[model samples]
Target chain A: MTYIIKTNNLTKIYQGKEVVSNVTMNIKKGEIYGFLGPNGAGKTTFMRMLMSLVKPSNGEIIICGEQVTPTSFELLKRIGCIIEYPVFYDKLTAKENLDLHCEYTGYYNKKEIDFVLDLVKLKDTEGKAVKDFSLGMKQRLGVARAIITKPEILILDEPINGLDPIGIKEFRNLFQKLSKDYGMTLLISSHILGEIEQIADTIGVIKDGKLIKEVLMEDIREENTAFIELKTNDVKKVAFEISHTLGISNFKILDEATIRIYDMKASEGEILKTLVVKDILVEAITRKNHSLEDYFLRIINGGGMNA
Target chain B: MLKLIKLEIKKFKLFNYYKGVLIANLGFIAFLSMIYFLERNDGNIPFENFEMAMNISSAAIRTTFIIFAAVLIVKLIIDEYKSKSIEIMFTYPIGRKKILTAKLMIVVAFTFIMVMSSTSLMAGLLYFAEAQFDIFPVELSFQDIVRNVYVNFFYALATAGLSLIPLLFGMRRKSAVATIVSAIFLATVTSTTSDNINLFSIIAIPVSLGVFGILIGYLAISKIEQVDVI
Candidate 1:
């Protein structure tokens, strides 16, 4: 697997405190690498360092096999990003802002502006100044600006922060299209697990300035163990039955009314039949799958994802 | 580098600034005419010599245009840092020093050109007015007015560099108020006159201040690469 972006021992310190510490990560080519973290988790600082807007306190970043130095600004031509909220020459209209961006990014294709605007559904901005845009519109414009250059790598920090539900879905689809069709490697940062889980091929969870976990979305889904949950008054008897007669040792007693059986040979029908034969009052029984949010919290909490 | 400067101008819509410059010129000419009329009529032997009139006008020009340059610095430089937009610019494919140099070039060029043109315009108009209306008993040779223009050119160049001094104060805290206020303070200090001998007349004072201002500009861009935008 070719890595499009790689960092070794990356760190940033401010006022004698480490904001991001010793993070070594690799983002594969043409993949959506989700950077997951809560607020103040140093995600913005990390992205800024990647852009060389902030110098790393220690370590280095290599992009497309070239080391990133203070003067290696030409390397930035290959990347497009929105480190925080999108900012622009708000006094100018949207087209003018995009024009300026293209000029600075050295992208001479003026037609690409309309193409990106259409991609983000901002075609009829009505010649309005960017200052007049709502948060959602600004977010869309931000995406448009990031993709206008057709960069090799896209680093977006909370790119969908202010979008509505439908807009979020649209961005999700857009990100996928950009990664799939345009072959752009994307590193998108966000705190929402469900939103990222839907789009990110690989997930990296950052908490307290350290990356606690980095794994493929499929691996996390595979860890989403399915279990049988039985809700009844005699939880102890069911637990005993689950261990002896059912011959399943992988089980947990959550409370007096809940017994979760992780491994069961008998089907739900057979299990209910056995309970009924044994004169057990089974109020309700159902199969449950762990959500990715729970799995994310487990990784953040440092283990016990299966339990 | 020139392309970057043009892009900066286009980005900030700086072409619109011409309206303000025109207004300043008109206001300044009116003020000079008022002073000429009042000093002559108020029993003070107004402009006893050609040098006195030039000195007074140069002082006013330095004060207004230097502060005007500072206002531009606030708009084009300090405000971007304050709003964190410079971070975005730094991420571009251009070198940080080149981008900053382009911006300072705009400010310095604007200040120098305006000061020289305004001073020359005033001197020319003053000479014609003397020939036309005999505003005062004082006389000026053609050579004297021509020499004054050359002198004002140097002063204008010095003022261009001196105008950068405000960036020192403004960048320290990224405060627009601090930038404008410090500019006003510098202009007042340089423009204060007594007997046609202000600090600028000393020649050494303005020159050194100009050097110091250029030094500040140098210091700002020297380490901009390593310094975090935050």
Candidate 2:
């Protein structure tokens, strides 16, 4: 796959502390690359480096095949970004802010301004100054501004921080449409996995200022093998019933109240029938995939030890 | 460069400051009138000599516009850093130094224009008052008027440079209050020299201060590319 953005040993140091250390990452063209990390995990710093807002102290970033020196800002013309949070001339209207953004990026098609506002549901905010805008409205407008130029790559850091549930869903659709319809490359950072899990083609989990894991969503999907989950108050009774009644050996007792049978040799119905025959209370049982959620938790909670 | 300057003005809505300028002019005129009435002691008027009158007026004008320029610097540059909006500007497809230069240029142009207009206003008003009231025994000749303009031009240029010094203080801490306070301090110390001291009375001091102020601006942004934006 041809990469549209690449970084080699990309790092940023603040006061002798490496906030981002040697993050050599690749992003393919027209793909949604989700940057997943908790708060203070150097996600914002990494995005800032990619956006050329912060000069990397000991590394290099190549975007569109151009090395971004302090003098070279031409590559920025092809990028749209909103770092940390959306900030605008507080006195100016949302429309005015978007227009200025377009002018700075040298994208002069004024008509697209209205189109992006409409897409982000900020079209009704005509004369209201941005200072009066609610945080959610500012977020919507931030997205509007980022996509207004139809930039080849969009670097949005924690773009969904203050959105309502409906707004998050709408943004998910919008991000998908931008990738599929306009062929835009997106690098979105979020601490919440649910925000990125739905639409991201690739997810990069970061921890303690380092990228712990990077994997394709397809590979994650393929690795989600089926497993049986059984919940009961009497874990000892269930463990005895599970092995004795079903002769199942590949199973794990998670806690006093839960067990996971990884082997699929026994069907759900047979296991439920055997539990009922043994006069044991099977409170709940269901077949669930070892989800990407588990993988995200393992990497995050383990602090890269598992990775 | 001009477009970048214009963009800065539009972004900050700086054109709305005309009202403040008008108010300053009205207050300046009132202040000069106060000096005219207050300094007349038993037929010994300060305006009897043209040089004393011009010296007092220029000092006041220099202080007002220098402080005004510092306020503009606070708005145009310091506040941007404080609010972190400068991150947005840096991400744009423009050189960082170029953006900073445009902001400082606006401050300089504003200091120059406001100083020139207000100085002329003060000069014209002084001439009109003398012509109408015949208060000064000294002649308000065309030569004096021409010289006033000439002297005020250099003062405006000098004040423009002097205005930039506060940028050094303001940027060091990225504080708005610090910027304005330094402006006041600089204006007072530089313009309040007694006549016998003969230090601030000459053009050389303000000119040197102006040049030093310009250097301060250069020093602030010299490492623009290498330094962390924060």
- Candidate 1: residue pairs that collide: none
In candidate 2 chain A, where is summed lDDT lowest over 10 consecutive residues? A298-307
Top candidate (lDDT): 1
Summarize candidate 2's per-residue lDDT along A74-159 as a digit string, tens digits: 88888888888798888899999988888777889999988888898888989999999999899999889888878899999888
Q: Tell me which residue pairs clash in candidate 2.
A: none
List the TM values for chain B, per candidate. Answer: 0.97, 0.94
For residues B1-230, write the lDDT of model 2, one tens digit per residue.
Answer: 89899888889889999998998889888887887777775445756566567777777778888899999999989889878888888888898899999999999989988988888888877888888887688777888888878888988888898799999889888988989999999888877846523345776797899899899989888888776775
Clashes of 2: 0
DockQ score for candidate 1 = 0.87
Give the share of true interchain contacts found in each model. 0.87, 0.77
